[model samples]
Target: MSSPVAMIPYTNMAPYRQLGAPRDCRFVPVVPRVSIGALLSGEVVAAAVPVGGLKALEGVVETVGRFGIAAEGECMSVLFFSCVPFEEMHFPRTIRVTGESASSVRLLYLLLGSIHGFNRLPHIAADGRVFDGELLIGDRALVKGQATAGEERHFITDLSQKWFDIHRLPFVFARWVVRKDAPGPIKSAISDWLDEFKAREASLVEQAVPEAARTLNLPPAAIRRYFQVIRRSLGERDVLGQQLFIRQFEERGRSLLFQPAP
Candidate 1:
């Protein structure tokens, strides 16, 4: 059998690898946490790794081209649903979080701390009944974002948009990455796909929407709006955002991996 690649099970991610990759590129649906394990264990050569967790994967894998999921202002997914008013939120209280993307959760914490002056940010587990807020990511986030009523909309915080509001830089959520020690064929295939994707991303993503909409059970227009906000290729500002996020993550003492104490 051919080598596999990890695919994060998110509707927003449909514009990436699903658009087109080599026939040898067998895709296996994996979540953010397990993706690294799959890549390192040789279960997969490449994965649509989370930018939030990028610091963790350093030296283990390298990002490919500018191919990634980024948002200039609003991601429309990766939302924080606060039980109380946005301004009234203070995190001595625990917030229920979906155990999905650590990256998104971290971004939430960063925003809560930096922008909101909330130093005591603690995202509790899903089972916790006593919580001040709920963090929803991926497709469910999109649904809640879409289905929200007038006043309810005031409470939902879009993490990517919040980042842009504070930093004025595009926020990248995930990117295609390959193991540094991956087989030549795997790396070469990803490189070739990146080359092909350079020009085709805009058009290909548009064309793929109907299918993605059907598969994801979201409206085609909603999908279009999402793609409108989502930038598949990272640019200078996007890189800046990544750097700032890493710096902040590390400074907050939430470094992804172990390091020597200085």
Candidate 2:
């Protein structure tokens, strides 16, 4: 029987997930956080876990390929929307995040606290109308970005763009990982399957555009442009960005992650 490999169902991951997997490994479509959980709990053999979520899974999973969801300056989906200026807003949403990704929420806290010197981070109520700021990722964020285009009421910030401005590296949101304890053959198969996935992505992405357009509820052109923004193959700079984000995750975000000022 083939091993199960997580396929994150996100617009940014349209290339990999839209295309069917190899015979040796089947694609299990799930969101990023769930993929991580499934991998750790032995539900799946491998997955593309978010970079921010990798801190706790240190030696449990092995990093597969350098390829993943990354971008140099702007990733259109992972956006932070604030009604007022960062300093003026009573508290831009931090803890409450789009369930699609927790790493995005963590990254927001890191940027806010580390660079902007914010101390107290507030948790947004589930399903509450966001008054301060809201962090949205994946397809929902892309939809929000499209809806707010040309509007100035919401202060929209691209997390990847912000990271690039601060660090000059491509922010790696997630990377491929496989079970370390899985038999050697399974590990090798996942790696080989990833390489094949990368090589075929360009054609697959084009094929996926129409489905993505309908699914994401965005114009085809917008979907096409977004694919250009999200780079699947990770380079050296992307690796550096992941390192910085993970390294600074705790050091700079200690205030928000650990104890919040009341």
Best by TM-score: 2
| Model 1 Cα lDDT, one tens digit per residue, 63-123 | 8887777889988888888767655555455676667785787787777776556444544
The RMSD (Cα, Å) of candidate 1 is 4.3
Candidate 1 Cα deviation (angstroms), residue 41: 2.2
lDDT of 2 by residue, 1-262 (tens): 8888888877777777665665577888888877777877888888888887787677889888786778899999999887765555334343345667858877777776655465545555445443467778888888988899679777888888888887888888888888899888888877887788788878888988998899877889999999988888888888888888888876666533523212
- Would you estimate the TM-scores of all the predictions? 0.88, 0.89
- In model 1, residue pairs whose N, Cα or C atoms come closer than 3 Å (at least 3 residues apart or on different chains), thus clashing, are none
The alpha-carbon lDDT assigned to residue 86 of candidate 1 equals: 50
TM-score of 2: 0.89
